[model samples]
Target: QLERGNLRTSWRKEHGHLRRAPVRASPLWNAKQRSVAAMRARVSRRPHRPSAKPKPAVSPLMLALVCCLCLFPPCLIWLLWRPSLGQRSWFRSPSPLPPPSPLAPLGEGNWTSALFLGDSSFVAAVHAAGHAFDAELVDERRPPLLVTVAEKADSPLLQNFLQSSILKHELRHWLVVALDSGVCEDLPDDVQWMACVSVPAQQEPADTAEPAMARPVNVKAQVLWATVKLGYDSLLVDTDVAFLQNPLPVLADYDRAHQQVRCGSAGAEPFLPHYPWLGAHVAESASTCESVIDLQAQRDEEHGIGAGFMRVKATPGGLLLLSRAMALSLKAPELTLQQSVSQAVGQLRGVITANTLPPATFPSRLVHLARPSRVFAYHQPCPKCVVVHSSWLTGHAAKVWRMKDQMLWSLDGPKKYYSDPKRKYIEYSNPSSMASQEAELNALKAAFMLGAMLDRTVILPEFRCHRCPTADGKGTTPKCSDMVTRCSLGAFGQLDLAKFAGAIPEDLFRERMFRYNPLTPKSAWGGSLFDSPVHLSFDSGKGGIGSLQASPEPGWEIQSSRAPEILSGAEVHPDNVLTPAADGSPTEDEVVAWFGSQTAPVLRFEHLYGLRPQFRHPARASAFDAMWNRATGM
Candidate 1:
């Protein structure tokens, strides 16, 4: 077959009649392509004809002039403005990632970290709170890291804050941004701290005419930026705050709703539920303006999120707010952190969404501190408050006292106070025999002073009142007492009581404290202490220690009097100073001896209405009067 084929092919080639192997066609296989190429060639060949007037060549000078004319303005502008270009970032570069945060290695799941600001002074507090969570048990969700910033490794304010938070809350995760050297050495090795040596010293605006980014609040803003930039949603909690319940869940719920609404409302009107950011003084009516941020700006500057207890998300709006606040703070050094944030929010209203924490869940010092009645009304049982911020008070000591009074203090030990077996407690009731609030108050004052002298924690008695302070705080509300207005302590009295609590050591008790104390003695349960828990057997309607037997006393008629009056054998004296001893009866030392003789864990008194302390030194009397005046707001 091969030979036959080869022979056929040869024959065909020789004869020029063999179906010659189909020759490859030209690349310009179509007539149209060939025609087009021919036309192009013909036109090229005929294009040598010169125009009647030939164009002149561009001179080097003219060319340079044209180029300069076109580019000079922009180049000059750029050169002149290049210095300011850094200030106006049209396209912001990614913020340099902070070295892995101390919070990263903690908790297993995604969790919001709690941020605190402090310095060297807070070292003790930080150490005390370092192991807020149990180390042995693995937490499915890590506790929020308590992050703080300080000017120096041992800044005083920061230290104070550490003390406050450590004592008040059992914090889990911890991270510290030590601005200066030695923090690592100062703090325990277990403490997770990052040294930020680059942080500039805080600058006072008065010292410099030009704005600087050295303000404490400004630095805080910068820290917030870095945190969110690292994808952390943080709870900015002041050290003064006390966690009654875990506030994270509440904050998380709000954040989830916030994100959901933001995501769901794309291309539609935003959902902004109005609540109080500062206090109830701000209006809650739905704003007519389309943007909530604008509405916030229009509201009083005093109103907005409380800087002390803020929930900062890592979302775009949150990041934008933080960045803008930081920039604004630098530009306007006079503005406070809260103010800068407000201004930034106003500017970013179009793109941002904000909501106030539910007041019922998160009560603040701003509203409750000024109005003591509200504190009791809404926060007494504190049925719903997740966290209580102890702020608006003047000093750290004052904040600590307030927390203790509210049964919110955690640093000393467990939440229970007056539980120490070594410590003694004195108990009394609103003298059922006394009819007037004034009489009852006098009794309370006497009891309080007596407790102080005895080194006992006075379990405060509930007042029997004809009228209670109205909820509005404007007037009295009548109780259902046979035709007369039956009342408990009035709002005014509560205010005075708050002052008293802040002024003194944690020596006095509110009914709630006694009722809530887990260590409350079984013998003390029968009395009608705020409707005793059903689990405790009730012996009588008398709450608290009312049912307990009164300590046996030979002489119950004790009256307070000045030493000079007693020494002079006279009743009247210029000084109001009174001793623990009864006037015309016993010496101060004798009085101490009498109380000291008692071996009882609790000394129950029938009533202080009739007992008048007899004598005291001038200094003692003055101190007593001061305490009395503060407690009564007289």
Candidate 2:
């Protein structure tokens, strides 16, 4: 068996070696191999060629040029087609801003009637007087005939019509409306053909009756309702309001829109969606309430309605709105007429749309000429504003009348005051005493600041004075001689240079006229008072060591090229007190004197003109007129 196994293993090994060994080529394979070997021998026998060298590294300039070439085509295309692309259907061009629309013009036929109401006949008369002033300025073709509503027919206040000066100017048709008795008595001269309405008597006091329990019994509301019923569009102006410009033009736009009612607000707050009563409803709908909430917050920041000025069109919707408001007022006596109107309008959302005049056109605060407070100070009368409400100053009739006189003076006096050369100096000079001058200056400053705050374009007298060279050898400068006729302060120290700085250009510092000369100092050149680092170069013509130094106290510094030579005989001129050293350099004493005298004025200028006005602090008198002139573009 061992011999057989060994023979088998040897046979297997022999077979494995045979299998591992290369198989002998077939006749066709041997011929193909011999051909391939002959082809290789033929290729190797041919001449050999060197491989190509690697390409040199690309240059930065060439790379940049290639990159630019790649990017330029698209940029060029965009520039060429930009305008046309904007005009494409998918791309919307930015819309141009709309032009400002002017207020509509008011004509006689615009309103059927103008209703004037007052708690007392005197109050009504005062308002009518103010209205007369405004009426003269209006271009009404046929102004609405004035209608005055009084509490009683025989009220003593209305008895002496001829005796009153205000009534003599404007013809008013009186209507006696007994609110307590629900009796309205129309006068024989009633232009609208208004009839007396008989209202039912109330079991409770007339004031205590509620609209829900009974019909609304408010005379004001009744007057509004009756005006609408008569088929006449009405303008209800409270007695305390002074019409600055005619409001009919503003009302005409609303008339065209078919807007039932329009009201002026006491403040700059917006109306409509921001009504206080709409707050609850806005809170109920969170998803749709964002706009309403934003509007409410904005309006809340502004002032509410001034029911004193209202426009009611002869539309059923407007009448209904007024009626609803009247009913609400009757139910809630605590609420004001304006609040009632707001609440009623809130409830009747889509039924009535009330227009509101912009607050800029109908500012709430009256321009108080006397005792001007900060609240009234910044709220100067806007030239475009239709009315100025003085309801807050009702009890101060004397002050109001004084303000009226001042207004008249302002309107008429400026032309006369500016034209006469003889009066110019006196008018601009200190008025009688320092105290009075100071007061007048303060008043003028306040007026300027207030005008600026209100964004009113203030017209000032032009500065036509001659340009004078300053004492400090600077070029000729424009003198505020016409505006600032006299300085109230004894010395320049008291002058408020900062106030003057605000009105003039920033280069005021370099003007030599305002510079201080130690030997021959003059107050006219007030600019010298500020302490600024001025560069000075000294040329002795001959080379020598010179030094410039600043004093510690007055803080004046001088940089010199050579040491100053003390001349044995230095001539000092009377006008030019400064004596030049032998080396033509100013001595330390001369520099000190020049700088010391100017120190106060410089500091004052820095405090006044160099800085912003501290509105809360009282302004100085000396700087007031000059500053005013600057502000007004004089």
Candidate 3:
């Protein structure tokens, strides 16, 4: 995943109706992985083998050449010697430990108790955990932050879990939560976040036909709530989670200290004594909020525990240290806290733990962060997550299949069909007067496929235009230049970009790995990569939001066209039966708005609907989705 550069899309016409795209295969990520594997597979010592006999004689010419090479140091060095200086093994050395003292943090032979806590799924998961499902409800924010903020529709259940986390009585037992909806206002009491940009006038997607946008939206708050409450030692789980064998034995063992502290064990590894906190314990004082572990790392370095599958050591020492880490990590404004704790530990100087603990130990507590497979659900369960909850309705079946490859059994997938807009839990946005949802989705594809510009060989048969650039200020497709001839893929990405900059999509991302060892730094050319979702929403002027309703904007048209042929409402097996992701894109208009971050698009719609003073215009989910499918081969 190693890479660098700001890659964007640029399309050009080729042939009469087709255009070729350039998209090079990603760098040799596999080869780099093998390189790392070899490093890991280094043997303790070379294997002993029978000695081989030395060769006898060399020709006179060869001897003379060798003599000549020896006489000339530079030639001799080039021909007779290999360079070891810049290669992998000769003289690599780690810096000396200075700040944190070395100490044996954790080891095996420790003990722990187990517990489970979360929402409705908790009952089923607890049954799966081989434990009793029990916990009382308590409100987090007084008056409930949902109503307090402009969004009065926020759900109490989601609010409580997101801010407070599960109350688990089990030691080393984890709690889980799910993120089903969009984030609440990105606001936290502890951390101050400046406005990155004006929250675009809360825009709605094209399909949302209500007089208002849907209410009770808040994923960020839920994540923060679960994260800040981790001292209780619970892992958050998404509802669709499946389990493997009983994790009691593994949880118990995860609490011990590493027995080999002297063998280069450092930082938090010292704290994870094999049995608790991985066998490592914290200083007794770490139990208090006053203790602070300053964590520092490069911005490029990512360290955070996924909200799913967090673990705690059962021992008092392990719990104490974990609590300490949690206390400091909770300071992060976002819900991302785990990696923060790990980073903090890595930052410390090591006079402290340098004297203690080994780097790794046996039988690791494997907490599956994603969904588990089927067999585990049927036979036993693994506490991949200790608590489970979400911002919106958690996907039931997808959770099971998230990691199905490792599972032995499977659940009957959930039933999903062409949705009824009035159906609860299904959400949609409205289209703006300026752009169409279809236009926006296409814009996004234009941006994504921009990567196609890198490789000159691949082309899109759909693009059939060769309009030459014009000098006039007007921006419109040329008339005479109707179609194409052969064009270079590089011409799209590398040609004169200023002219089409506005028509180009700017928001693009690559997976995290592309920034690492495999791809060269120059491989990807976008800006930064994000782990969070970024979308453009349409806003017209409406308020009382509800998922099933339309945007709270007047003069807004959320149009949908009926399919030419009526398709049967039958389930499409594994796919439709399973209910694929609803994490949809911006409304048709937003796609057209891809010109600039803030600029709106220009397009016409027959009518508008939703918002105060509501007027009627047909805007249905099925119709819009149908139109969407036809416009883009989505």
Give the TM-score (vs. native) of candidate 1.
0.50
lDDT at position 178, candidate 1: 59
Predicted candidate 1 versus true structure: per-residue lDDT over 1-634, tens digit per residue: 6896898678787988546665455675777778999999999888577667656687778999999899978876775455334223443222322322333312111212222223334333333333333221221222333455554523433443444454334444444555566543444354333222223345333323344566555656656555554544545655566566665555544434443343454453323344324322222322333222211111221646666666565455676677677667656768887788777766765466655666566666644433443322223254555666765566554555455445454332343343444456666654352245555666767777667667776766555445554444345455523322222332323444456655666645444234343344444333333321211222233433443333332224344342222223322222122234344344456657767665555556544554455335878878878877876775
How would you order the candidates by TM-score, starting with the best?
Answer: 1, 2, 3
CA error at residue 493 for candidate 2, angstroms = 28
| Residue-level error in angstroms, candidate 3, position 194 | 40
Off by over 4 Å in 2: 1-218, 254-303, 366-381, 394-399, 402-634
Using TM-score as the yardstick, the better of models 1 and 2 is 1
lDDT of 1: 0.49
Clashes of each: 31, 22, 155
The residue-by-residue lDDT of candidate 3 on 1-634, one tens digit each, is 2232222222232243555445565579768878888876775356867889776588779998988877878744554343332222233322221111112223211211111113334233322222211121111110001101122222232232223332112222232222223333332323221111112223222332322222112222222222222222223333222223333333332322223332334553553432343223333213333222211111111232332233322223334334334334334434233444454344432311211111121111122221221111221233233322221112322222222222221221122111111111101111222222343334334333222221111111111113332222112234324232212111121223222222332222221111111111222123223211111122212211221122121222222232111112311111111111222222333333331231111111212211111112235444434433443336
Poorest lDDT segment (10 consecutive residues) of candidate 2: 292-301
Considering every candidate listed, which one attains the maximal TM-score? 1
User: Candidate 3, overall lDDT?
Assistant: 0.26
> Candidate 2 residues 1-634, lDDT tens each?
6896687678877786655434465799899999999999999999997899777699779999999999988866775566534433243443322211212212212121222212244233322322222222222222232333344422222222211211333333233333334234222233232223233323122344443323222445556554444443445544344555555555443232221112223343333432343323322422321111101100111225456566555455566666676666555766665667667667766554454555555544432321222121122334555554544432332223322322311111223221222110000111121222233334334323422332222222111123432333223355533332322111122223344444543322121211111111223232334433222222222212132122112321222222112111322112222233423243334433443334232221100001122232244433644556663433
How does each model score on lDDT? 0.49, 0.35, 0.26
